[model samples]
Target: MFASSRKSSLFSSLFQTPHIICRGSSRNRVISGSDIAASSKVSAQWTRLGLSEKKPQEQKPAYATSDQRMASLSELKEIFRKADAVCFDVDSTVIKEEGIDELAKFCGVGDAVAEMTRRAMGGSLTFRAALTERLALIRPTREQVQALITEHPPRLTEGIKELVHKLHQRNIQVFLISGGFHSIVEHVATQLDIPLTNIYANRLKFYFNGEYAGFDETQLTAESGGKGKVIGLLKEKYGFRKIVMVGDGATDMEACPPADGFIGFGGNVTRQQVKEKAKWYITDFEELLRELDSDSIKMNHNDIFY
Candidate 1:
């Protein structure tokens, strides 16, 4: 889907309105001086455009893009490049679909489960509670789950394979942390070559007869604020000097204090709150891939799996 290294319109997208008119292709676009003035005026209201807020007491630069904090963007990328490990949120971040939502759809309780998931993600309902209620609605049997997997395997986000391969070449460890089921993310890990041991996600329980029983509540990912716990554990376990969490949710944002930094991803889905708060918000993996400086590694896209 992301086959083209198309220029990300993140800035241009936010800059457009009834006033400021942009002309030409997204690449060769042009805006009049009046438009620039309009964009600048709008820049003063970054929060309204879902742009990140300036750090308290930090002066906004006149030269900064309407998104603001151009300097902080550079600072975050420096951290990303130095990171010893990077943790990714599995559903929308690593794959194209939300695993639980997909499972719910497969089980034919899509609408009921999806509403709960929306609230869970928005932080109104605790993740643990949402999962409990959603699972109660799904009650998917082992066979059904397997059938869904075989029929509709997890769709990897475009550019992810290349990105993970690049991280590996940098000798940086990669992890998949998700509120999705273990069975689902394990498949994703296998596809990405991330060690199964590095996969942190919820585990489903089933009866001996292969019927759905429930989920293991003991897993940290089974509850709210679980992703941060996982990041904290990773920090303690590895003693890594720098770790970056990249995802598209509030849960992902919550992982950062435990994680050294958090980079928001929006290639598949953009969470507005995530976009507004992330000091370094990106819509495509290419933005990140460019930051890695591939010249040092000397690898080709063809060798990603090898």
Candidate 2:
């Protein structure tokens, strides 16, 4: 189980406006007061596509069950010991809430949107169809979008910050790749101290009057197997010998052949297909840290960093 204290720490860090410090650079870097003000203004203007409201309680789907979906922690630890990079799916894997679903709720179409999301994630519906349908239903306004950011910010998954920090210390490049919208994902990447350039997701377009228009059709993540394609590109560009994908959806599982490993995360929502297919599955991120600390898995720092 995820500890309450860890969740608290993650929430605290995520909501605060970051004052990024540049390390190992001769030019001392500090986020200027003006810059912070500008960021806050932009966040205020284009945050999320929802109004502030109590999130409806999410019911676990009947499909989720207690099954042996993971290898022994030791086995997983050994498998990932040499990973040079890690890619994470944002929505349910790294955050406790689904951004689009929340937006739909704010638009008073929660049930409809939730059903489509469930189908899409379960591999019953194509991601492109689901996204297109849901976006049309919501038709979120500019003000509503910004309110979603300010009023109902996405909550971080338990122990994710610690996991990311540890991976960074080990020189593993952490990337957040999602089928979600870039408007929200960009903020998440910034909060986690992940470079914006490393983040990949769909981008939404708004009319000059701030009305919802549509999304960029050209983004690779707009269709099925997009996550896998992104992973393939990363491998080609970085020449990473070993890469891992951590997510809670079938889309994440699609990255397996390109990614050396796939770890299913079910802390928020569990999908039966992902649980069954993943080589390892965990409900708590702390389990990963514990496995990484095991002595049986020798850390080859050189192989991972260089």
Candidate 3:
């Protein structure tokens, strides 16, 4: 995705300031003075065509084109090259469904539980509080939860296994931090070759009848910016020079500002806030891995077992 001629210049620009109109990968085409003046005239024309004459900030750059705005994988690759570790969120980030919402579906409270889940994810409600209320409503049977997991396994996002394997090759630790159930993510942790100790997520409690009682509230993810806490903990433990975070939720956004780089995975679900705040936004894991210069590793859906 690199425009070799402009790649270096783009990097230079990006590092020049935190905020600027980034000339995307394909945006380096030369424009003469006449073209620039013509562009300004065109902007004035377009402004006159609008409902109001209020002009937008500097008018659209006459040179900006759809191709120029197209995001390239090279920027992300450069950032990841020096990254020491990447922390991923499980549900929706690595896995497809919100675990509790899936459980709610199995237990006949899908709509209600899903609503709460959305609110929690959308920043309307606290994750821990919502989780408690939802779990209380859908006291699912162990068989049901296990069955759902069996039917719909926790599949890793596209190219995630390859990314993980590449990180492994570099001896960089990968941590799966989630607010989802341990029963599910544990299997995924094993498949991804991440240690159980590195898999920080919520745990479930069951009764003698193999029915769900509730979730363990003691997990770090139950708190606000739980993912950030994990990031902080890892930073303190490993003393790494740089850390990267990858996820697809508000919870993930909390860690974005704290990490050296934050990649938003929009393959499963894309949130506007996440897309806006992430250091990089990608529609799939393949692009993410490719951008990170970690494409050499092989991956498969089986890497994220149920």
Q: Write the per-residue lDDT of candidate 3 for residues 111-220, one digit (tens) a residue.
A: 99877766766667677888788888888776776666556555666677887887787677788998887767776776688887888887777766776666666668
lDDT of 1 by residue, 1-306 (tens): 111121222112112222323556666667899999987787778967789755668774222223322336667777788888999998899999888888888888889887777777666777788888889989988777766666677888889999999999889999999999887777777778898899898777777677787887888898888998888787778877777899999889987776767899998887899999888898889878887855344344546431
Q: Name the 10 consecutive residues with the lowest summed lDDT in model 1.
A: 2-11
Q: Lowest-lDDT window of 10 residues in candidate 2?
A: 1-10
Report the number of the highest-TM-score candidate: 1
Q: Candidate 3 clash total?
A: 1
Q: Residues 1-306, candidate 2, lDDT per residue (tens digit)?
A: 111221222222123332334557487778899999987776666647454434578784232223424446555566576588999999998888788887788779999888777676566768788888889989987667666666667788889988888788778899999998776776677668888788889877667677777776677899888998888788778777677889998889877766767899999998888898777888989988876655324444434321
lDDT of 2: 0.75
- Which regions of candidate 3 are displaced past 4 Å? 1-79, 121-124, 294-306
- Checking candidate 3 for backbone clashes, the offending pairs are 77-291
| Cα lDDT listed for each candidate | 0.78, 0.75, 0.69
Instruction: Give the candidate order by descending TM-score.
Output: 1, 2, 3
Pairwise lDDT winner, candidates 1 and 2: 1
